[model samples]
Target chain A: MDKSTKCALCPQKAVVHLKYFNRKLCKQHFSELTQDRIRKNISKNELVDKNNRVAVAVSGGKDSTTLLYSLANFAEKFPIELVGITIDEGIEGYRSESLKVVEKNYKKLGIEYKILRYENEVGKPMDEIVKKDQRLPCSYCGVFRRDLLNKAALEVDADKIATGHNLDDEVQSILMNYIRGDFSRLARTGTKTAADTGFVQRIKPLSVVPEKEIALYAMLNNFEVYWGECPYSHEAFRSEIRDTLNRWEERSPGTKYQIYNGAENLKELLKGAIGGAILFECEICGTPSPSVICKSCEMKKEVR
Target chain B: MDKSTKCALCPQKAVVHLKYFNRKLCKQHFSELTQDRIRKNISKNELVDKNNRVAVAVSGGKDSTTLLYSLANFAEKFPIELVGITIDEGIEGYRSESLKVVEKNYKKLGIEYKILRYENEVGKPMDEIVKKDQRLPCSYCGVFRRDLLNKAALEVDADKIATGHNLDDEVQSILMNYIRGDFSRLARTGTKTAADTGFVQRIKPLSVVPEKEIALYAMLNNFEVYWGECPYSHEAFRSEIRDTLNRWEERSPGTKYQIYNGAENLKELLKGAIGGAILFECEICGTPSPSVICKSCEMKKEVR
Candidate 1:
């Protein structure tokens, strides 16, 4: 982001410097590059194709907001139906505030959208759940929110559920599972998301895009986005990994990409063993799970 | 080590506290437990058994000396034939001094041993190779020594080549390759070593024991071991992993064991794809390699 540096693609002043590829870009070229990357990722992974309705999960955060805009443009350019799905976990000072940003974006973009709240969907909002459950808020909130999003997307008849999980998120998850030695939860097959049973095949169009670039994209475009951490969000394990990975990336750029590539290679190798892993229906909620009870249903049982 | 703490197994004063198992033991019981772990690991992994000739690669270091003793005691109890093999890399003052301690231990224990110097086996010793080669001494030294050990073990008609790789070494190697994303070399099958193409299978009897315990065992047993570091030894990546793993182990005990366990599970999953990987004989030295030329033969070519 040098003031005097020229864009790698043009003579305009470089506003964003991508350390991984050693590329500098101006506003226009940077937007184009970011959009092109997302478009290519979508097409390459077959995340969105002609006449397919994609439910883009937005959290009103920078990543999700940027993904909404990116996907909107992609929908216009290509022949795909687009819808926005936002889950309000009902955390105090967080969900209500961010919901406004998401609503504004949905209205402005003229996209069909649904906002599911934990209060209505799961009977207990995150604020209430946190006060009751001694466990970490994220432990159940994440599982609950993910389930709500998937169910909502499926209700809308969407063929795919695309999340705003950036490259940093993917790399952190890969390394996190690796460090914890949780091989079953590590990398597996089918592009980014391959679903069976009642699970909708999820996709990440912005998987290749780093989080910083998404923030920059949101800022450069002046998108109405709520850029704040959730009050109930305290994922200790993930935060540690995020800090370590960022420091490693600072010293060694493209380390994230290498990790992702390695995980993909590992997925192919693990494909056979994990590919046949069957999903069972939760006896309580009828959600596809590896056990008799889905995590969300278990959370619901605890809440009740 | 508590001043007045009683041994977990006996009334004697505790000398070593095993954090992983939360056990404290006296000098005698600690030795018994350490030996028990090694013996159990050997039997469980089937590293050594009755009537099989095993070559113990003794480098005169604490781990090797402890491993040598442990294996000898194991051999005596289990009816196995044991022979010591020492590789003299000729690292100036380092090797000559350590070789003396190894010879002393061999005579005291009445064990059959062979001291193979790099000068006689390969064209050049490590000291000379370090001077000529611009790469790290370990790059060539590791491959060359491994080849030499395999050949000597085969020459001695041994069933397996047992090395002094303790838990720390095993965990460090697992993390190093993992961090590097070198999955091909990460983890495979056959307990610790699965060999083909005239390659002697390798085994690590002390893979379950920590390095600190090895040092303590040597001290308690009063084994004649050369206590020093190799002047030519400086593994940057491994050192980094070692330091980080130590810090993690301090904060969260048994992190090392978890990593090792996770790797074993991963190995089982990866066994099918990697199990059939065929090793070919090097055209030059007729050693087993994935390529036409083995690493040792390639090094020989470079040396010549």
Candidate 2:
């Protein structure tokens, strides 16, 4: 925002100052740096490969929009095909608003995309489920969305399912699992590219980038990013963690990265000790799960 | 405070409501339950055995006061001799006020105890160090206090050193390490009975109980605990974490205990992977340390 401040790499006046990196950048270099990091995040983890078909879960949020755009840009020179998988959770105002942005962006990119609805795929619309279930909407929404995403990615034959989980989401889940004393959950919190039987490997190319950076990246590139809060809202504990982490990120700019990097290392160490994830096919739906029945089937049973 | 509410075990009116246990207890039953948990924590961990001389690090704060009193009370039936090890950081009014409570409680219990002054043992009073050094007093104070506790415990021929680290403190340290990505420190944060070479084993019997419970126990038993905050304060990140955790604790009553329990389990898992504590004697002073020289010596040298 400081026009007088020049870019750290170039003479162009800085458009955004990144506190975590302690650097200022112009529009040109900022995009270069962000995209470069995203590319590194993908290649380092081998989330995508030559001739591999990758399905990205794009919600039209700033994070997903940025990820889709970045991947699409990279795909121009690369041999990989990018498919956008957007889930219409049917949250009334929530899904309808973001759906427009998803369609528009996918159209501009001209990438093959699929739109999956909750009613068609998961047995119930989220709005109806909200009315019937006494539980918070997030608990059900997460299970359903993840279930739908995985299944849809498999249908399109995605070698890996790349998600738009930014660094904030990564750290928040890590801390939440820690708070819950669930080591197994904590171990699986990492953005692993490994796949088990009947499950598609999920990858996060934007896991290293901060949420703010994603917004800025979206803005500078003029991507159609939908900024909307869900009517049903977030998990309460998560909101607390997100706000606390934000304040902490402000207090010390790169604290989240440190925690996340440490978590990744710790997760590897835990997986070694706990023997990684011991997933099995759900008895009801044949989905890979820790328990006899997958959460998707369990929730569907509850709703029915 | 609810006089009409009957104790879960007895006819006496319940004085305390413990949400973690979801139980109401009378004055007598509450004491019994807390002390029972403390005793189990000690015995289960093998922190103290028959004929062991245990030196308790009593800060005269509610937590330490509760720990010392609990040990002293247990010593009546057990053969273990309880020695009170109090540290005077010499922070003007900070040590002066607490020192009185430490002495009074020690005398009342008729336990032989030793007081180690920071000036005598660590080569600097905290006040002078605070004035001379640019760093926060806490950074220096914690190292000095820990060092003095270890040395003083050794001099008293104590087999183990016990401290009043409650659940809140335990969970906070676990999270702080996680936040900082210091897995080594994270592994060492758990209450372990095993001591490294040339160091007295340290234990925390109060690790199971919450801070609020300790305060209630102190007040209910009329323990004469000192209530004061030092002019030189906590680490900034810790304060932020503590406040955030307090709010989280309110949001979900048993959350802190869950986190602490999970941390304890996770620490064990990490210790196995990381090969436990790798300590060496300080080259200069021959104290047990992870590095070539112990932190106490490093800090002592810095002050000099």
Candidate 3:
């Protein structure tokens, strides 16, 4: 019953009995456990390359924190270099809190980190856009975040941008896009978005772990993750999809895993089978888009 | 604009148009529009019978009420009796409100009505069974509804039971069932379920009308409708499908219609080619089922 007792899965539990938090897992297994999930997802997806430089998009949530921690560990052993990047969405409280955690975690890991503040780059903050449009906060946040993340990765000369999106998030997105007949987004939703050109390869290392597991891991590891809901997330259709899937998970355990596996199995067929030609390069930004322009540009104009 | 003036296509536009809540349509056109949808759907589908003693399951919702009203009108001039059977699911507030509308409409139309209440008939009320069981509400509701509807048709000496299900509901059910890999339901879901020994055929007259249009028609026609949401529907996954389709509709107005039509066109292949024996007669109930015992009986025993 001792709070300081060795964690159950810790190899040290068998000998020295050193406990980290309340878990019986030794520091080694605890580290390996988190790393194993990250590595397995990457290997299974064929996402990482030995010669590729990876830029980890760290938002300091459980997902991004765990992702950065694991990628840093993976880079120490692999032939790849891991660099951390953060996009300051300029949300007064949430982004600032998240950035503090990201920087603290990166400094602890001694990883090369870059922070791209939206105010400095986008010339307009998300708060202003959200207040003005009132129709789409995500329209602005998603576009700016993605653009900044990719731009940061390219600036650092990374060949791939590694995101902390877990299995539940990825599968929910796949299901959402598929349900909406958004074949273009559906085609690009897997762990590795293969056909995307003029953009660095995007990979999700935690694409197999469930949301609860990541939260638990982050908690057990004493990660300084900001436990707060995104203000704009309530209106997000993605949140609705998440809640919908979460409700399903409550009824049938491991449904999220099944959905993840189903999405993975579908990647091969969906790549070429959804035969519409929306995969043209954006003439302005050179990102994959259905039209001559990217969604970001379209949204910016649409919002204006 | 004179408020008393009716829109050219709608008769009771002054009263019913309020419920339709959308400005683009008038009362008569609303009803005609709903009927046109059903007719077009029925025409495109290879399942409706011009001479068969087709039964319509009257639930008293706007969709079913409209379906019953239209079916009565269509059958009056055609060679069909259009037997109207209502299954009482025994849900409080729901069945009663709907019954009022149904009974009133049936009385005005002088259509023969069959009401099968669940508790005295199905051995137990669904509300009671649901309290004891952890299975989904729809699971019990669907099973009890289907069996009772079939039994009602047989008792009334009819060939097919027609339900008020519309395009949006059908597509949602299809996607939900398909996602769960329920091939049997997929194979069975069409405009008309085929004939098997001891089992009455089933058809959907409102199969093409959208739920919104059905609501509009019900309001325009002075059919009393239950406007309250099902207390248990919050937990059902169909709403997610509906929302998904709605989002898709926002993106592309005709996607649901196209998808249903695609499935509608596949009816022949589903019946003749796919050839699932799951619809074979159940010895106990003399209904079509894969086993000698039907799903309802199996569930009943399991619950007990």
Candidate 4:
């Protein structure tokens, strides 16, 4: 591999390139560019703080791996204390890959990893619950995932939890919410949320990164990923949103980028409209919410 | 054919049950259960009053035709005036059938009918404009249709513009709006609205009626209807919503109806969020809108 050639990771070649862990990447490293932008965005937007002991919501997916990797990189420079939190939903053939990648990355990066099992915590595997329940799979998974992530973050004594939600996902969600007119979800959605205040503040560092860039960065770094989709993803409405956004992106190449910028521009409008102060604690779990009981607690109680 | 048996047309056993008008309708009863239920819903909900002069927006489709037919029927019994308004979007190989149906229905029913040709009023047909502007045809068509409807409504001096939107359409739109997080649209959505100070209120008398019910009513009554779909509708994002909702509905009967009801429940919540307010006049067209310019004026500008 000729060093003079463009970095295999990112096509962009900047002059002040840095060699980290034998990877020849430009100063504008794909991961770094993404991570730095997200970090600065969150900080600038007043999302994260020095007092926060953040929980890394690791799923062992490429996005989560990149998040963990970048947070570790950021920690070397910043005084941020980070710990890994993984929730195993106990889906057959799915959780294993994510678990392996998450555990391996935590070990490799020397971060404390806490595995919260769904069956142990929620009293049943998501698959079993979904199979028996008449509710949509996504309805179950979303409620369970949120419940577990928040609970794990709280149990581990972390003030903030970081997840790897990307631009494509965010925009799709924005579009989906707009289409369905789901104002509550839209109002609640942001790069960071204090909704689960008693549990953990959730932040997305990769919120600005596009799907292509994340995939490229993951590939270049040879990050172990769970390539197959969740078997119970029949309820994933996001795929429709992804395709819709992708169509627009393809027709107008920079549309997705513009959407990210739009999100940034609309941040204040969204905050004002969505209102951050709507937070209250769930009566059942004492989790943060806009209502007396959080959605997850409501769902869990209903399911039971 | 079988008088004692259920009438294929009416699907109801009433004294007025007969295959009147050659459609094999069970009877020429003043109130078919669904139509009566719909009218009673409109009446009980106080959707319309004797003081109102309503413009029935017709597209020559089954739903709209059924709406107009029922509205005409209502006019006969109740002290109400009815006018039909059609906006011609100028799509090739389409609209002709619907236009014919509209004309035939109006002529037979002796109802006043007005046609707003897009070429004359909006200065361009949808297909031609879409080709030049690279915008989705339905996006442009929807705006034009709405603008024209309001324009024609105002032209006819009608208090309320009645649309043929049914349960499925409402559910799909609610879902789409929720998915897109557009609370504004969801806020103003329903069978009826207050004559919210600055705008002409729109009403959907067929609000409780399902699409199939409308189609059956149209077929049984021999109400002429355009069976073909809009040429540009394939590009619509709502189709995906429709598909998703359709599958959900099939999985659970009356699920779509419940979703519509859920949307109704959220109407107040949506209004308090963004996209609140009813139609205000378009500064350009002097038509009703919550936005500065009406959607039609916006689309016309976009195409021009």
Q: Which candidate ranks first by DockQ, i.e. highest? A: 2
TM-score of chain A of 1: 0.95
- lDDT for each residue of candidate 2 in B1-304, tens digit (9 for 90 to 100): 3335888898998988886667899999998989999988888877788999999999889999999899988888889999999899987787799999999999999989999998888777888888889888888888888888988998899999999998888888888988887887777556764465457888888998888889999999999988998888967878888998998888888888888888878877776676656778789888877899888788898997
- Candidate 1: which stretches are off by over 4 Å? A1-6, A23-29, A187-191, A275-278, B1-4, B189-191, B275-278
Model 1 lDDT, residue A253, Cα: 84
Give the higher-TM-score candidate: 2 or 4: 2
Residue lDDT tens for model 3, A1-304: 5655555754356222212233456556755666787887777667887878889898888899888877777777778888899998778878877778788888998889898987776766677667777666776778878987988998899989999898778878866654554545555667877634657889888887777768877877788897876777645567666777776676656667666665455444344544455467778667667678877766656554
lDDT of each prediction vs. the true structure?
A: 0.83, 0.85, 0.71, 0.73
Model 1: lDDT of residue A65: 88
Candidate 1 per-residue lDDT, tens place, A149-226, comes to 889998898998888889989888887677778766775422466555468778888888889989989999999989
The list of candidate 2 runs beyond 4 A from truth reads A1-4, A276-279, B1-6, B276-279
What is the model-wide C-alpha lDDT for candidate 4? Answer: 0.73
RMSD (Å) per prediction? 2.7, 2.6, 7.7, 8.2
Tens-place lDDT per residue, model 4, A1-304, is 3566566576767433323223456545655665667678667766667766889998888788888887888787777888999999888788876788788889998999788887887777777788778877787777778888878887789878899898888887765554454645655666876544455678888887777777777777787766667787874466655775676566445656665554444344445445445668778877767799888777766665
DockQ of predicted model 1: 0.54
Tell me the deviation in Å of residue B102 in model 2.
2.0
Candidate 4 lDDT over residue span B1-304, tens digit each: 4545555555575433322222334445433666886888789778788968999999888888888888888888888899899988888778866788789889998999789998898888776787897766676776777767877888899999999999888887776555444555566667886566455689998888777767777776777788998777754456655776666555446666666765675565434445445556679878667787877777777777
User: What C-alpha lDDT, on a 0 to 100 scale, does residue A275 get in candidate 4?
Assistant: 44
Per-model TM against the reference: 0.93, 0.93, 0.65, 0.68
